[model samples]
Target chain A: MPELLILVPFTGALLCFLFPGHIRDVIGLLCAVLTFVASIILTGNIYQNGPIRLNLGGWKEPLGIGMCVDGLSVLFIFLTGIVGLLVSLYSVSFFSKANNQSLAKHFWPLWLFLWGSLNSIFFVSDIFNAYVVMELISISAAALAALSGTNASLIAALRYFLLAMAGSMAFLLGVGFLYAQTGTLDMYLLGAVTDGGPLMAMALGLMTVGLIMKTALFPFHFWLPPAHGEAPAPVSAVLSALVIKGSFYLLLRIWCTVFQDTTASPQTATLLGLLGLTGVIWGSYQAIIQNRLKLIIAYSSVGQVGYLFLLFPLVFITLDPAWKIEAWTACVFQTISHGLAKAALFLAAGNLIHATGTENLKSMRNIADRLPMTTFTLALAGVSLMGLPPSGGFVAKWMLLQSILASGQWWLAAAPILGGLLTAAYIFRILSQAFVSDDQISCCGHVSFVMEKSALLLAIFSILIGFRSKEVIFLLSEQVYFVIQGGIIP
Target chain B: MTTLLIYAFTSIILFSIGLFGLVSHPNLIRKIVSLNIMGGGAFLFLISLAYHGRSPDIDPVPQAMVLTGIVVTISATAFALCLTRRIREKTGQCLLEHCPDKPET
Candidate 1:
């Protein structure tokens, strides 16, 4: 049954690539829905029997390839399914408006293929295969970013493309070092074999740098704002929301599992936490200074990513021995909430930009009455972004704060809170402008309801996450590590 | 240990040179070219470290990964070039350092 969850997207991608142009969006939406349903079923299976494991091509563990579906993979899987669906819905209206028939045909296949790549990355038992999936995702993402057909977007995509390649190559080298030392690429096998040695340490450094580059953490984030800001809105939504998380999810999983022993020095995790802390300040500063709305959201993503990494160091050993579950639960929850909220925000921004024919802040200040639904959805998404009361972002922030404080790392809490305020500041910058109702409002065509509804629905889900903390926490704690390693680690 | 350190040094030097080229060059195509050189250095470093100090003896897994990374990087570069050429066609200039400020929409 868990196998079905991964297979659905793969088959869907191929079908999408083969479909007739006119029906591709419909087929893609159906595929995303099916993938979501399958994931729900898979979650039920996990509820019954912890983590579900399957070997693809009949390969055994520590030998051939395998799929390990744990709480984290399921979380990301569910996110990809839902986000993939909404982006498709948004794109139908989006590309249709510009009469971009060519892009419409290509969008589904690339998105579905990306969905498959992302899902598989979370589940792959071997580090080597994870590298392959990373490359696949990068190609598709670069292609998607170029869909704008704008000169700025095209150059931005190219720059992003080069950086992603460089990062991937660095990761490949790190995998090499690991394989040399441990003689195994399987995460489970590596867990048993490797200790905090020099080669392994060096490998971890390489991998971390590579992953940070992809995550656009801070110093390495020059490629992000351009790639994200210049791309079409729906593409930007997925790039920020779903795709970027793939590398981080793997990094986190590796730290908790394969690189678990490497954290013994404490400096390693502390250094990472410091980087995240730095990112929060730097990214927020940039976001605040941006005049364009989408650029603001893109820079803000750099800030949010910091919290995820910092939370790692804050919770390394402080949680109640059982508190690993709570900390990771909060971590995963924070990630998904951000994804949902960011997607909605971008979609709303897209529709508004479309209606007003510009994303300039001075222009959108009078955009409120003309596009009320888009305005409301942006505010709703902002609630999640700001970590305000009753939104999932609020719950995620609360849980992370509790974990950090519990760990006695009081410094960590400052970032998320400050980050939230900045998030509120920038998001509200757009929100206030959205309320502009002056006669000077020069706008474009009205957006179709199709684009607005799914976006609102996503924003609502982000808020609804606040109420489901119990269930979501339970799901995140369900043994993702053991699923990959087959409970073989000592 | 000495051999590993030497390989790492060479990789870092090459990487630094490529980085310098990438940052210093204004041409979009040259940046891509420099970036790939950096990638080559990094990949070689990985292969060198993963080599078990013997011919046909190094682990095949990382080798396979490096191969896949090569293909993927090439594919991404191709797409990026297509985008770059298109951008040149439209705006007549690629952003080298400071982008020419177009008044905000």
Candidate 2:
């Protein structure tokens, strides 16, 4: 199944590359749907059984490559599926309107290749393989960012490409150090051999820093807004919604498993949590001030990324199982909900920009009347962004609050609440402009139902996720081994 | 010092220089070159890790990984160079600076 997940999109990408025409989009959509179906089946199989483990070439754990699909991988795989399907649907409409058929040809191959790379990242258990997956994702993503051929996007892609390369090199170097010490690249094996030492600490530090740069955490988040904001809308949605999560997932995998015993000290975890706290405050403030709609959403990603980091401290500070489960649940929930809502927001924003032919929030006055569904999608996605009740964001926030209060870590608990308010403020900026009546609203193109429906469905899912907390929590916790606990240290 | 120590220190120095070049240089091409240098340092480090007391008894994993890393780095560098070229052709500037004259959309 894991092999199928990687093969389907990759093969589709090759087909698209060979046949770059109207047929490419159809092929791309078919591949994405097939991948999603395979992922769902994989998840169901994991549920019935424990975890699925595959040893490539029949080589055992420490000797050759192995892949594991635990609860975490299953959740992320599902996320890639949901977001991949919607983005593919949205892209078909998006690129058709673009009129540059040649660009569409380039887009299908790169996008599907990116989708394949993301699934590979989630499925691979070996750290070095993960590095390769990261590189593939970065290259494809950089190409996609430059697909629009605009000067702004081109520059952004250039900068993004450099940072991603540098970051991955640092990651590779860390992999070197770990291999030197443990003589293995499998994360689970590294857990057994690793001890608290300077080399391990240095390796952890280097890898964490590298992943942070790639993940765009706190001070390193400078490259994200430009890259995500300037890309074509569906591409922006993919980059913002799914690409960064790849590195974030890598960080989570490394910290919890490979570095479980030797790393994640109280001070280091708190330091990360502090950065997450700062990112929430800083990114939300930046989002509120942006005039362009996509920039605002991009900056909000920088903020929401902070929420994921908060889990590190909350999980590290307590030894209680309940606390760990709650923090883990909240963090994963936040990631999924954020991916759905942000993708919806970008697609809807893109449709609005298409209709009005301008990206400025001020110029977007009275667009709600013309594009009701798009506006409604924006509002629905905003509800999740603001952590409103009866939405996935609210559930994640509520769980996070419960965990923080349980641990009595009151200082950092305020970040999420304050971030929510800040999120509300920026979302209101767009929604308010939507209400005003403007006589000279210039619409440049027709908004397709395909585009609007895709955005709306993702937004609705983001909201509906709030109601599925029990099932999601069950799926995440049951029948799946937590790698940190299952590893040799414990 | 042992040969391993010497190689390790050389790789570290190379990495430091590459990181410094990356941070200090404003030109995109220079930055890309710096990235390649940093990647070279990592690859060197990985290869050195393969040296376990003798020539024939080296670790093959890091070698395989280094080989993969080199290919990945080349593709990224190639892509970055192409993007830099495109940016130069479009805007006539290699440095990524925000010109205050043009408004951001």
The prediction achieving the highest DockQ against the true structure is 2
Model 1 per-residue lDDT at B62: 55
TM-score of 2: 0.96
Error of 1 at A313 (Å): 1.4
For model 1, the superposed segments whose C-alpha errors exceed 4 Å read A1-7, A15-20, A317-324, A442-444, A482-490, B1-20, B42-59, B91-105
Per-residue accuracy of model 2 over A266-354 as CA lDDT, tens digit each: 89889999999999999999999999999999999999999999988888776676777788789989999999999999999899888
Interface RMSD of each: 3.5, 2.8
Determine which window of 10 residues in candidate 1 chain A has minimal summed lDDT: A481-490
TM-score of candidate 1 against the unseen true structure: 0.91
TM-score of each model, paired residue for residue:
0.91, 0.96
> What DockQ results for candidate 2?
0.61
DockQ of each: 0.44, 0.61
Error of 2 at B72 (Å): 1.2
Q: Write the per-residue lDDT of candidate 1 for residues B1-105, one digit (tens) a residue.
A: 688778878877887777788778888888878878787777777666556565566666556666776776677677767766776777676554434445222
TM-score of the first chain alone, every candidate: 0.94, 0.97
